[model samples]
Target: MSDKPNLEEVTSFDKSKLKKTETQEKNPLPSKETIEQEKQAGSS
Candidate 1:
């Protein structure tokens, strides 16, 4: 219910103007194979 900016307005703004940065994820998510293995292990 707060006065947040509209999605339409936000999307219309130019993103190319923003600064770019080279960054890596500190904690990356598990791969699909790892996830499947974990799920199978849990279900067993």
Candidate 2:
């Protein structure tokens, strides 16, 4: 395994320090519905 830090590891470390979830930046991904909608729109 690489020594490089993963986001989950870094974020978990912060949580151990009592960091608030709401205050932390979240990684958002497009939902399947939204992705399909965009694809359909583009293909039109």
TM-score of each: 0.42, 0.42
- Summarize candidate 2's per-residue lDDT along 1-44 as a digit string, tens digits: 88976688665564456755556547888899999999999999
- The whole-model lDDT of each prediction reads 0.92, 0.79
Alpha-carbon runs more than 4 Å astray in model 2: 1-25
* Model 1 C-alpha lDDT per residue in residues 1-44, reported as the tens digit of each score: 76986698777899899999999999999999999999999999
lDDT of 2 at 43: 100
User: Over 4 Å off in model 1, which ranges?
Assistant: 1-24
